[model samples]
Target chain A: AQSVTQPDIHITVSEGASLELRCNYSYGATPYLFWYVQSPGQGLQLLLKYFSGDTLVQGIKGFEAEFKRSQSSFNLRKPSVHWSDAAEYFCAVGAQDYGQNFVFGPGTRLSVLP
Target chain B: DAMVIQNPRYQVTQFGKPVTLSCSQTLNHNVMYWYQQKSSQAPKLLFHYYDKDFNNEADTPDNFQSRRPNTSFCFLDIRSPGLGDAAMYLCATDQGGGNQPQHFGDGTRLSIL
Candidate 1:
């Protein structure tokens, strides 16, 4: 079974500071990676996704993720985070098969100190 | 325009009483999914419907049931609400699989009393 691991359970950063969230996955075949952000009392919004080709994928809200095949990692990064960026971020992996089963990580809570 | 809609953003039900949460999609996606998310935990997939075919997760409790009457609507039914079932129920739709980003509704926050 494919699984995703997010090492940090909670992280706090000051506003205007750079941020990086770590994510690692374990899958047999080439993996499809995705990042989702969930705000308080709201549904999840897609941040970015890496299916194939380029290792670096850009997403909405000035967020980006890089797919590292060797490290089995797809980390989300933002040059500068705003107060609104504070939310729960999840990393997920999808199977290459037809079923396209997607497994989610435990998620990391990001806190921005203004 | 909101692509996905989940009714009764907050619901309170007595224990052992059956409650239904509705989700409707305007995207006309082929796959619709129900996910249960508790505080400080990942969202767990309860079940999904691909067209008319139903796929329930292996560990999903029989107490929780789902119905997809057509392409536009899906419902989650809790036969017996328990304290453990008090959580946010999220409804999402996708074209086929994870390759496409799944659109999500605001979700229904279920409370068991």
Candidate 2:
């Protein structure tokens, strides 16, 4: 079974500061990874996804992530963050051939300070 | 824009009362999924329909049932609600292709009293 681990349960960063949210996965084969953001009282919005090819993927709202195969990690990074960027971040892993399922990490709550 | 839509942004039902949440999508994706998300938690998959084929999670309680009458619509029916059932019910759609992304609805907040 594939599982995800997000080391940080909650992260607080000052506005305009750079940020990085860590995500690690346990999968036997090459896995498809994704990053999503959910604001309070709202559904999730896809930040980006990694299928194959480029190890580095770019996402919306000035966000990006790199897939390190050997490390089994895909971490989200941003050079600077805004107050509106505060939300919950989730990293998910799935396989193209697997059943329509994505094992999601517990999630990381992001709070931006002014 | 083509998107997923869940009716009744907020629903309040009494305990033991039966409630149903409906989802419709303009994207016409073959796969539709229902997920439950509690406060400060990740979305938990309840079940999904793949071109009318219903797939329920192993641990999903029997009280939670789902129906997909056609391609564009799906419904989540709770036979008897409990406090634990109170959460945000979300609907999402996928193209049923490898590496395809799932689009989500705004979700319905169910409050059991």
TM-scores for every candidate against the unseen true structure: 0.98, 0.98
lDDT of 1 by residue, B18-49 (tens): 99999999999999999999998999999999
lDDT of 1 at B27: 95
Model 1, C-alpha of B101: deviation from truth (Å): 1.8
lDDT of 2 by residue, A2-111 (tens): 89999999999999999999999988888889999999988889999999999999999999999999999999999999999999999988766748487789999999
Pairs that collide in candidate 1 are: none
Instruction: Tell me the lDDT of model 1 at B78.
Output: 98
Off by over 4 Å in 2: none
Q: Model 1: per-residue lDDT, tens digit, A1-114?
A: 799999999999999999999999999988888999999989988999999999999999999999999999999999999999999999999887747578999999999999
Residues B1-113, candidate 2: write the lDDT tens digits.
Answer: 99999998999999999999999999989999999999998999999999988999999999999999999999999999999999999999988853777789999999999
Model 1 stretches with alpha carbons more than 4 Å out: none
Q: After superposition, how far is residue B2 of candidate 2 from its true place, in Å?
A: 0.8
In candidate 1, the second chain superimposes onto the true chain B with a TM-score of 0.98
- RMSD of candidates 1 onward, in order: 1.0, 1.0
DockQ computed for model 1 against the true two-chain complex using alpha carbons: 0.68
